[model samples]
Target: MTAHSRNTPQFYLTAPSPCPYLKGQFERKVFTHLVGDDAAQLNDLLTHGGFRRSQTIAYRPACETCRACVSVRVRVDAFEWTKAFRRNRALNADLVGLDRDATPNSEQYSLFRAYLDSRHSDGGMADMTVLDYATMVEDSHVRTRLVEYRRRGPDTAVNGRGAGPLYAVALVDHLSDGLSLVYSFYEPEHRDRGLGTHVILDHVQRARALGLPYLYLGYWVEGSAKMDYKRRFRPQEHLGPAGWELKDG
Candidate 1:
């Protein structure tokens, strides 16, 4: 029998759109729905095959004339922090991350808006309202969580979590094999602290503690400066024609 006959996913291709990662290129995506009781399992399988989830949709690049985008996942067990990464971690020591259920809140919206205004002011999500932010966080059917980062408060030692002003937030998806970093945003003024890199490092540590083998970093498009930092997570695997292969420095 065919995979679809076994209730496996049916894929569909999206219409061409202006590429968000690179200028002067059109992009298309082949996607499948994540729904029903099997959504979690299906999402895991698809993600392993180099797909990324957005709400209930699992998609990957299917551009006709370009192949710049490549899916990347760090091998958690073998990952080692470089000197720069260590410095970034140390610089953000005052920040604490807390993982909570995938629910929307005004605080998250406020930070998200500031992040967009600072970093992605001319990007597509610049005009997103609170309701749009809420949908981005809570519309998913698969297992998801919101990781909040804030300044460490005096009471953190007793509470074991931050209780100060929010600084960053990441929308994460839990898969059987690994954790997918769906999206993340942080305070723009704190750019010098490398809060973005710190968050990914924290997730890598969290995955190791959870016994998960990989931390999916999503697509890394070649020639895109915005995605260049992803390569810093050494001993990472990139999805290619032969499946996941380790990329050498």
Candidate 2:
């Protein structure tokens, strides 16, 4: 056995559990801790290698006999907005996104609670408390930013931050090569507006403007309706054994 150095991350596998994306299937994850001075740089490389960060740990699916979880990243500069995407963008013309330090507050928690109740009531994170929400935002040992979406209101000229109530929020990580969308949620009542897709489109444009090459959108599980939307982002790359391959379809 090779001796491990302090800089080497130790990997662990989660105990088999019921798969969240697939019915009647078990799932496991291979993960390692993200900490210390090199955590940010290590996270960037691991993320490109198909790992995803959840708080202080970086993980990816490692289930036996399953290849359903595919990592996806948009080609920022080449992404073309579809007619529907354009419409969604127009629909949200009055909305503005404000990036701030990852500090949890009551307002964000209220919106987060409503989002969980309406969109993911039966999911694992549905029962998360305000403290849990805070940990999700503030527990990171990496470069993270909280992007809050709100509608423009009176006195918009005074403060650059959007006014009115919060409609969506995304926890994003800044990597060396691109931006990683860790998690995002929106006002479930406005689901018809396609706020989720719109946020992604906006992020893609932001990444391109910043000279970044990709926008990570987490895992795309095959056969999961909740994850089907990810495939709509054309000119995306999917990570596989052979490496990241462009998916035209």
Candidate 3:
């Protein structure tokens, strides 16, 4: 069935839970299961409507009193790299990212674990096991890719794949209008390289190369220091009551 077929999507609200991004706040979500033949199309519509996907689920914040979680996307055609962003890209010039089908790897899990331990020890996904990682990457029905970033090695000229340990990895979805960054993590020790920022920059380039208009960056929680980096990608659009509008940083 197509996304507009008679089978209508059913959305549900989650019970109150402690807000992950902001303290002293409770968070709720309106979510639906993305499945069947129309999963990809449904995903596209939901995403454009301000929902985000996790595995086979699409969800968006539906808090009772707070609207802190604002959906953000980078406007690819209008994106211009600032001096700081250019420096971030230059800092990781030795690394290359290889796009692979959404599949789980032990090495990716190892780096994921290290990243969780080092950066988000008390966060929601800190205790995720290898199986969970596998499901996160492989359980999707929509177009998804796991891009692994690594340092250039001896065989770099022969094959495009980078050699040595993994420096960073991003779980991304290819949507009709843009690429959606589902989740990403990098080697904690390499924080100086600003790999997180580089990953977004790379995706912006990828979207531009693909002729996509936007690169979805998921929710940007206002006042959350952890989400401050997202605002750096200027010429972005924030989905609000009036719909997506340009927010020039």
Relative to the true structure, how large is the alpha-carbon lDDT of every model?
A: 0.91, 0.91, 0.93
Q: Which lDDT tens digits does candidate 1 get at residues 1-249?
A: 634543567889999999998999999999988887888989998999999998888999999999999999999999988899889888989988888999999988988999999899999999999999998899887889989998898888887689778878999998897899999999888878888898899999999999999999999999999999999997899999999999997
lDDT, candidate 3, 1-249, per-residue tens = 636544468889999999998889999999998998899999999999999999999999999989999999999988988999889888999999998998898999999999999999999998899999999999998999989999998888788889989999999999999999999999999879998999999999999999999999999999999998889887999999999988866
Off by over 4 Å in 2: 1-4, 154-159
- List the pairs of residues colliding in candidate 3: none
TM-score of each: 0.95, 0.96, 0.96
Native-to-model Cα distance after best TM-score fit, residue 123 in candidate 1, in Å: 1.4
Q: Which residue runs of candidate 3 sit more than 4 Å off their true CA positions? A: 1-6
Candidate 3: 10-residue stretch with minimal lDDT = 1-10
Residue-pair clash count for candidate 1: 0
lDDT of 2 by residue, 1-249 (tens): 989876789999999999999998899999999998889989999998999999999999999978899999999888878898889999998888888998889988998899889888999998899999999999988999999999987766678678888999989999998999998888889988888987898899878988999999999999999999999887899999999999989
Q: Is candidate 1 or candidate 2 better by TM-score?
A: 2
Off by over 4 Å in 1: 1-8
